[model samples]
Each structure stands twice: as structure tokens, then as C-alpha cells.
Target: MTTLVTDTGHPVITAWSAVSPYGIGRDAYAAGLRERRGTVTGLGPEHGTTPDGVGCVVPGFGVREVLGKKGTRSMDRVTGLAVTAVGALLDDAERNRAVGTGEGAAFTLGTTTGSAQSMMDFTRDSLTGEQPFFVDPARFPNTVMNCAAGQSAIWYQLKGPNATIAGGRAAGLHALNYARRLLGSGRARTVLCGAAEEFSPARAWLEHRCLDGTDSADSAEGAVPPLGEGCAMLLVEPRAPEDAGQPVLAEILAVELGVVLDGADPRPALVTCLRSALHRAGATPADVAAVARSGAPGRAGGAETEAVHEVLGTAGPADLTPAPLIGDTGAAAAAFQAAALLAFAADRPQQAAGRIGVITSVDRTGSVGCALLRLR
Candidate 1:
């Protein structure tokens, strides 16, 4: 397992925001979680004939509508989600002050692919158009996987390092680990780290086909969970002495990542990640107050549950499963899982204060990871 933090002081997450299925912004998401509201809604004509005919999409969200039409004509759903989420994070006066735009601020985004629908649509247009070169130039940027990350940096004027990592459902953890390193290396004073995914007919059918082919009981009838779309971002910076007066949402103790080769049981790999993260954080299983499970459907879900049990015991920590309320959020799964941790802490401060919360993820793509956080 790779430990994300060492001698360097652990980075602190000061503020976070989300444009999720519950709706836009942090407050909406927190309220939805508190009410245990379900976000799944029937698929419209735009999504074609999905296997489930339903999805957990950001209600009434549109790129041009949410973000003004200025420079938004070519923006795709994923990019719009990411940009909106970053805007929400910076909207807070306190967070905005700490993360003022310039060379000192950076942006890192996690995604499976920038927007599968955009790429497919662009490709289809090229093939069906009168000529291959007749495609619209405005839409070409959406074909690349780094468009969202780059666009976010441009939109927010974040002049430091801008990168994108594609790690399926575990991408959020990967982005957080990257942000920690950036701070430790003094590459940026503040880093906006997060992940985004969009709901579309292309993604829905692709996921359905992949799950339908997997040899898991949950996929026996191709009854995979509905796809969900959204973005979640966190403001991460060094826990420096000058910021003593600022309230820290959580201290990121350790982020451990690992991989399991195909045909091997992922449970052992995830167990190792969880154990390593706790050890590096100088904490034990008994100190864990809650767990944010990935809640991935099918074989991966069962493996993740067993792995948590192996490390933290079957009844050790309270489970925070975001999938039930948000559906399958793909690349944004782990980010939403982190949000769930903070949301839980906010609702029950007395019970959550001074406790450790764990977030675990196991993706069918063979990625396994866990993060340990000291809730404050």
C-alpha cells in the first residue's frame, strides 16, 4: 500500500461543495442526506432506452442554464458540473479568501473519461457528417479527457498545476492524494481536488452492458443500479500555524491506495489498504466512529463489505452508504463518500467530534483504496 502522507503535516480540508443528485451546493446535499431523500427519477427521452429507465441526476440542471450562456455553448455536462462545483466552493467568503485565484492555487480533477457521451457524440458526428473534417470545432475540446480539468482552471483562474486522473470509482481518493502531495511539495498553497461524472444514454448503456457481462449474482438480470451524475470539490491546504483560527472540516490523516489483479479476490487488497491507512494515521480500528462505504453494486460491493469487516469488524463502525440515496455515481462515488462523512459529522457534532471516520472504495476495474480522516 502507498501511504499518501509522511513527515509532512497532513493537509486539512477547510471547505467543500457539491453539485449532486440532491441538487446544487453543500446545503442542498446535506439536507437531502439528513432527510434520507431519494434522488432517482425516470429517464427522459434524451437518455434513450436505459435498462432501468431511471437515474439520479441533478434536478433541473443544465450547462447553459446553471452557468450563464457566456462561453458555455460548447461545455459538456461533466465540465459544467465540475465548473459549477468549483464556483460553489469559492463562493464562501472564508474559503475564497484562502483560495484566491493565482499561481498559488491549483486544480485537480478525477474522472473515468471527461465525458463519454461527448466523445461518442463527437465521433458519431464525424462518421455521419458529409465529411470527416466537417465536425464542429467547438465540440472538439470535449473529446479529450483533460478538458474538464483544464476548463476549470481557466474558468477559475487557478494558475498552478492542473491535472486529471482517471481511476474509475476510486478517482476521488486519487485526486485527494495528489492534492496532499502538491501541498507538501509547496507547489501550491491551495488545491481544489474533486471528481465529476455525468448521466447520459451512452454512459448508461455502457455500464449496463459491462455489469450485465460480469459474473455476479447482482447482475443476474442486468439489474444494475441506476447511473447518477454530479461533482464534489474540497478546498485542501496545509494545516499551518497561521490558519489556527480557521475551522478545519477534517484533517486528512492518511490515504492508502492499492490494486488487485484480475481473478484475485479484491477483499484482501482492500483489507491491506484499510489496515495501512489506520496504521499510518496512528489510530486503531477501535477509534473509528463510522465508515463511508463505496456501495458499488455486484461483486465489488460484497468484497468491499467483507474487507471492511475483516479490518474493522462486522459491527465496528456505523456505515454511511451514499449509493442508496444517490445511486451509482461512478467517478464521483468516493468524493460523495467523503461528503457523507462531513455531512454526518455536521449533523451530530457531539457524537462525531474527535473521532476517526474511514472511507473505503473497491472498483471492478481492480482499484482499491481507503482514507482515514480525523473529524473535527
Candidate 2:
């Protein structure tokens, strides 16, 4: 059954900000996506020159300019990405004084893993240092995955519940669910939520080791998208007729999450999540105007796309794989897809009005998540 929501229970996105391979800010993101440009590149000798050195990274992202040199000294790349995006979101929201930074406001985010580079560096220091105490004390905080979420709250003066979830590709959906729950339950009126991943030496090695790190996972059928890093954040709050802070990018009609049993095929789980999310949102596949699919190479991607086509038929050229433009963004992939879709809806109001779309995130481990959104 779909989770029932009231006028105040429905979550609507008021503002969004993104730091992608395209650069900082949603304009850069939309331009990159619209132009079909990707930032994936081969690693240079500094990062270990190997044939497998291909991935997407945010270009010219400087924490010194954004957060200043002193405050960013202890921050890791992933945290830096998150904080930058949050600052941008607040900046946009402040244009109308929409930033409600009190206990009624919350901060939540998802990540593939903590700061990969930080964990690697600190662990190396401990293992090879003259003593355990030789490790840099300031570097310890970034080792926790929650650092980004916590830092956003601290940096932005957001005094509310802060949460961080780790779900790889599915983390964005998880953060959405958590934010929605908080809004529906009256725990927080407005929630800033999103996901982020960092492109670093450690992450690059992990990508190569997986063997599925190619820019395209299915070159035989279509282009293999690049793996990317960056952060995307959205401001969500319960909805009402008078709640017109920012023309809502979209409404979170329904959200569903499912998991495949260990060793079981994920196809069925993916299908169930899609159907369930649509049903809960009071939408049929026919009502879905677009879809953004997130999965690895092979059947994972095929399964999600095929299931949507089977249930809803064709959304035509609007069906998109963001990997080509932004790369596989790990935890941030689903959120990025939603941001892309939001940009799409905003640009093509005639096409998006009265139509709904769905964003699906299927993790390699088994979790399948879907969010049904209607443009407003």
C-alpha cells in the first residue's frame, strides 16, 4: 500500500544546489547536462598512471575560496563538496529569506563511504608513523561518514537533527525517505537533504579494482557513462496551497524502498520498488512522463529500464542515463538524476506540466529505491 500523506504531509522541493563535474552551482550542472559534456578523464602520474585511470572529477573546486583556507584545513574532499553545495543552497534560499535555520529545519545527506582519501591517509599514518599519536588530530573527524552532514549544519548554522546514511547508489533515496518522514511526522518543517561522493586516489583504485569502472558499462548497446564525484542538495518541506516559497521543482508524491534477499536476483526487487512507488504516489506508469535509472553495468541498468518500459511503456527521448554527462556518482547518482530531471521539468514546462516522473536507484548489494515526483 502507498504511504498515505496529507496536505502538510507531502514534501515539496523548494531549492536545490549541486557541485558536479560540470563545476559548482546548478547552472553549470544544467549546462553540462544540456550540452551532453562529461568530465571523466584519465588519471595523471600523480594519481598513479595506469591504463585503468579513468573517472569523473569536479574541476577547479577550491575549498579555500568557498570555506576559506583556515576552516577547510581539516576537511576532506567529500566533506568539502557537501559543504560547498549546502552553502550554495542557502545562498539561493536566502534570496527570498527561505532559510528556516532552527530546530524545525534539518540537515541530512548520504555518501558511498566516508572520506575515502581521509580514511586511507589516516590509516596509513597510523600504520607507518613513528607512533599512534603521530597521526594529525585534526584529520580524525573526517574519518566518520557523518562528518559532511554535521559540517553542513555547523557551517550553515542549521540547528536541527543531522543524519547521514550510507547506501552507495541508494543513499540519495534513503536520505529522501528520512527527510520525508521527518516532515510528515512534524519533526522538522524543512529539511536539506542530498548525497555526495569524492573522486580521489583511493576511490579511483577501488573503481579500477571493480572492473566495471569504464565510462560506459554497456558500450555494445549504448555509451558507458563515466564514474563521477560531487554533491547535490535539495531543500524539502511539507506542502500547502499557500506554500509558495520557491516555485516547487517537484513534489515528492511517494517513495518506496525494497531489498533483494542475499544471492537472489535483484530484478524482481527493482520491479517491485518501481510499481510500489508509483502506486503509493497515486500514479500509473502511463502517468509517468520521464525516468532516471541508476544501476551498474549489465542487467542492473537493463533491469531498471526494462521494468519501467514494461510497466509504463516509453517516456520517449526523455529517458536519460546521467552517466554520460556526470558519470556514475556513487551515492550522489540518484540525487543528481533527480536534479537533472528537475532541471528538465523546469526548462520544458509545457512537457512537464500535468506529468509525473520517477527516479530509481538500485544498489549492487540488493536495495532498490524509487521516488515518484510530479512537477509543479
Candidate 3:
């Protein structure tokens, strides 16, 4: 296992995150964390207003700004979020590199709905209006699963292996694991790894099918996920103690992924995944300082996670449903959790040693993934 540290003398988290409901930056995120405030609120009709009052929307930067004017015309909303996030991560690395160049940067992106909006838009247009022959061919490329990863590499001039994975909620954690493996196998000098999800009207509709949308339901009491949107990126390197912009927040100790069939509880596989990750990291449940759970502020996911904690007997130190504040950013959920854990460690460095922050994700397809992280 490797213990990564940032340049600021904290454990090496290297390059980390940026997330918000209102285009707020890292400082704002820190403030929200400190205040325990929820970023979710009702977006007015100026944007895409929903019948339901709650939403997590990005405040600033539109598609045109995130992707260039020409690029924006061809990209979907989710692609826009991914490009912006990956750009921020690469920029962070460029500004803080103590040793190597950015040419060797690798990328692994995760997402559940890569271009659902695009598909929905095209379908609606076809049914409502005359057939349009002038459809832009460039836009078609962005509809594929790997489009975000490909676009990010093209934008940043990265020449390393590019990968995309999606197994519902496990997507982000799985992507991180892929990047970690690349570094460990000496395949790349550095990696840009993360996930991004875009909120769509369809998502809310899907939730209605699985959950009851009522005022009385606590955020966690809803039957389905409270879908939201955001992006998070991490820069991983093989070497430790590089002169990066920030101190090390934590190291990537271990990662594990497991598959369970539909209707299976997944608790067993999840527990095994966690135990395997801890064992690989040479740690135990007691070594974990906090658990950054990918709970969606809904009952099914939360109950399953709670059951896992019960089995492990380690629920007290973990933070439950932190995503309710920012909303569930699809593929970015686990990556966001990873970033949050690192930031939390950085703020409380004295208490971070030997304390591993565990990130867990369970996909609707019954796949489970766990990542074990610790400060150096």
C-alpha cells in the first residue's frame, strides 16, 4: 500500500477536489462543511425549474464557459461538468508540481448517465418537430460512455491510457481504483481520476417510481436517491512527498470491487470488499477514523450501509449522508467523498494518523466498491 502526501507536509492527497451547488469554490466548500449547511435548495424558474423545490445546481459557469463555444455546441451537460472538473484538476497539478511534467497524466472517469439529456432531447425533438437533417455530427461523439474521458484527454493533451467505468454508484470508486492500479503497476507517472453526474428531469421522474415524494419524508426517509449533480477530481502520482500545491491530505491505501446479483442484499460482498481493502492496507476497522459513505439521503442505501456498519461495528465515527448537502453527483459521489475525507483530514491533521477514511458505493446493478484511504 502507498501513503500519498500533499506538498504542504500533510499526508499526500496530491491534487483533490472542487464541488458546490452554487458554483462555490474550495473555500466555500470548507465553510459549508464547517457550518454543516445544506447546499440544496429550490432553483428559481430562470434556469430549469422543477415542480419540486429541492435541487443542487451549479451557480456559475455555463456550457459555453466550461467547454469552448464550438465545444459547447457538441457536448452534453454532463460532459461540460466533466471537462470543467478535469480542467481544474490539471490546473492544480500544473500550478504545484515540484518534479515532473503534466504530459504523462492519465485519466479514469466514472458516470451513470453520460448523455441522458442528449438522448432525451433528441427523442423529444424527433417526436415534436419535422426530422432535422442538419444534426451536428460532432455532437454524436459526446453521447458515448467514454466521451467524457476522451474529451478531457483531448482538452488537456494527456497521452496516457484513458478509461471509463460505470456500475451505477460504484462507478466513481471503481475509477479511482483503476487509477491507483495504474500508478502501482508503473503504467503512468501521474493520473487524473474522478467522476461527474448531471441532473436531468428524467432522474427526478425515475426517483418517483422508486420512492414517495412527500414533505413528511426526512431527507433520508425517501424511497429513492435524491439525485443531484457535481464533479470531483484527484491527481495521483507514484512518488510521495512531491512539491504539490497542498499538503498531503491522505494516501490511497487500498481499493476493492465486488459484484452481486440483482435482489441480493450485497451486504456480504460489501463487507468482504471492506475487509479486503483494510487487510491490503494492513489496517483494521479500528484504524478507520471516519467513513465517507455514499448514502443518498434515502432509506434503501442508508439502511444497507447501516447494516454493513453493524456487521463491522464501526458506524459511530462515520459521516452519514453528507451528500444530502451537495446532493448525489452520480459518478462523482465516491470521488467527492474521497475529496471530502482528505479535506477533513487536512483540517484535523493531528488526529489523522493511522486513521483511514473508508469510501463505499453500491450500484443499482448490485456492484459494490470500497476504497481505503489514510494519512501518511
Each model's TM-score, in the order given? 0.95, 0.92, 0.85
Error of 3 at 294 (Å): 0.7
Off by over 4 Å in 2: 1-7, 44-51, 95-97, 212-224, 244-246, 315-317
RMSD of 1: 3.4
lDDT of all predictions? 0.87, 0.78, 0.68
| Pairs in clash, predicted candidate 1 | none
Assess candidate 3 and give its TM-score to the true structure: 0.85
lDDT by residue (349-373, candidate 2, tens digit) is 8888768878887766677888888
lDDT by residue (241-270, candidate 3, tens digit) is: 344544455677778888887657667778
Using TM-score as the yardstick, the better of models 2 and 3 is 2
Candidate 1 C-alpha lDDT tens digits along 1-376: 2222232588888888899999999999999988999988997886677777999999989899999989999999999999999999888666564564676787889899889999999999989999998899999999899999999999989988898999999999999999888888777878899999999888988887786345336442223567899999988878865655666889999999999896577899999999889889999989998899888877778788889988999886878878888988999999999998998899888878889999999888899999998999
lDDT ranking, best first: 1, 2, 3
